[model samples]
Target: MRIDPALRALRSNPDSQRIAQTALETCKSGWRSAEGNASIFAELIRYGRGDELGECPALSSLFADLDRAAALVEDLVSQILPQIAAHPLGQVPFRHQYSGGMAVLQLAAAGDAALSLVMYERSGDTPHSPTICFTDTERHEIALAGSGTMQIVRRNRGRRAPAELSVSSVEMKSGQNLSLCGMFETKRIESVEERLVILRLGRTGAAPEPSLEFRVADGELVHQASGDKRDSCHELMVSLLGRMGRCDAAPVLAEMTRSGSDHLRWQALRECLALDTATGFTALCGIARNPADTLSANAGSLRAQLIEAYPELAAFEKTLCLA
Candidate 1:
């Protein structure tokens, strides 16, 4: 799996949007289990319209569940919406409409996906609104225009109780391949050792590269080459060198010159400078003059750059310079 592409797409969106999408997906997938339903419901309701409640049977049963779901949805929406709406990327639309004595709220997405949110309200001396929120994930497409409606009624029982009902209707004519709507925030990168483990376990995916890049970025070449527990990193590197070649690990190659192990240092010396005018030339020069190793590859550009900056290599420039 090429995780980098997905990571790139997610980075294009706000971190909060990603997190909220992740939370919403987790809730839908039943990862939170029954105990988490209430919190999920509250989050769905917070930005949702009071009249949109009828779309979900769970929301309608809020009273039976002590309105726990409603409260959770409300809290989540309240906490997340301000940040999501305030994001500078694009605007998310929320519209409120009233018809036949009922109020409806609809949400529209202006960026990648088309979304609708609904709320319902009943009229009387005291009116109540119920809300529900939803995203279209099954079609793997973007919604162009979607709408939601809610209905509310007043009942004259002995107690004069009020009854509320709402329905959210969505029609998506067009769609885009989007990461699950609620999955933006839940993605995480694993450690280098863990990545090696996964690679060894045959989990061939792009998820490991970023982690490996981090190790190189932090100047942890020894850690990258030598696996934490076993010689796995070494074996992996050797295999990758044979198949993908050393240049493929350019970032890592750049750091190998400073590696603790002599073997790694030599490997870096040979491989890091193999490609003409590669980025790792500076490190290659240090290895060439170490006396323990011979400079087989040409290093003219390396010497030129070094002489211009350090001037001390001027005398030995002829031998070190690539032909």
Candidate 2:
């Protein structure tokens, strides 16, 4: 493999201590150049052993320097490995390629114990191919680099609400790829609901992103709203009901019509007529047949408009019509 100028400079340095210090600092800073760091470490090990470079006073110092650099690298890995292993997105094997090389790491959590990690490395211009691994007797495959994006998907099977399960996606850094995606379901479950959370971390210049979804039975979709405000889901549902008659959203319209709130009842009445003729007509019949019920004035006006627009509502209008 060809060495970059930065790697070449670190390899040729006469002072091993300075070279090792720089390597430690780069790793500490979470450097974007993984290939460069790996190359420098490989060279440092070769020189420290006095195999690649002739013996000299610097060789003894090089050994100590290399040791310190290796320790730092191990420390950095130790701290990050646990977090990656526990991450829902990190549970899968992932691989990515950049201009120089690629890395593949498989992650798994061992019951309450430490995480299990298996890492692979390769260098070249071509992308890495997909690989497979097993966890809890199940097998999964990781995608080839530059194929499509990888995501973590969670499915709930128990009698709990759909919102109880969570799913998410994470993006790998350039030259870094995801090698596997796995599915995990807990056996020792809890009663509290769960939501899908996706965590994405990119290269140093790239921003981290996350997406969440809450699903309920009967095709109810609740999207998270922007800002720190609480109750966004309920707020969004209310806003959607307000603009009903304009869109063909039958589920939410049905929900609004069944709502006990008078405001929601009025909104649903206006939107239902534009949704579907059969369903809208049936809803109007229910209101006309129960004119004594406390429906808002707006709801009543909408009923009147339905009669005027569709003469079919004329018979029920007599029963609901008030002087």
| Maximum-lDDT candidate | 2
- Model 1 gets an lDDT of 0.36
Runs in model 1 lying further than 4 Å from the true structure? 1-232, 246-248, 275-277, 290-323
Error of 2 at 35 (Å): 51
On residues 124-214, what C-alpha lDDT tens digit does candidate 2 reach at each position? 2333222211122122122122222334444443435433444355543223323221222211111111111111111110111112233
Measured over all alpha carbons after superposition, the RMSD of each candidate to the real structure, in angstroms, is: 24.9, 22.0
Measured by TM-score, the strongest candidate is 2
Q: TM-score, each model?
A: 0.19, 0.23
Count of backbone collisions within predicted model 2 = 18
- Local distance difference test, candidate 2: 0.38
- lDDT for residue 141 in candidate 1, whole number 0-100: 19
Where does candidate 2 have its weakest 10-residue lDDT segment? 196-205
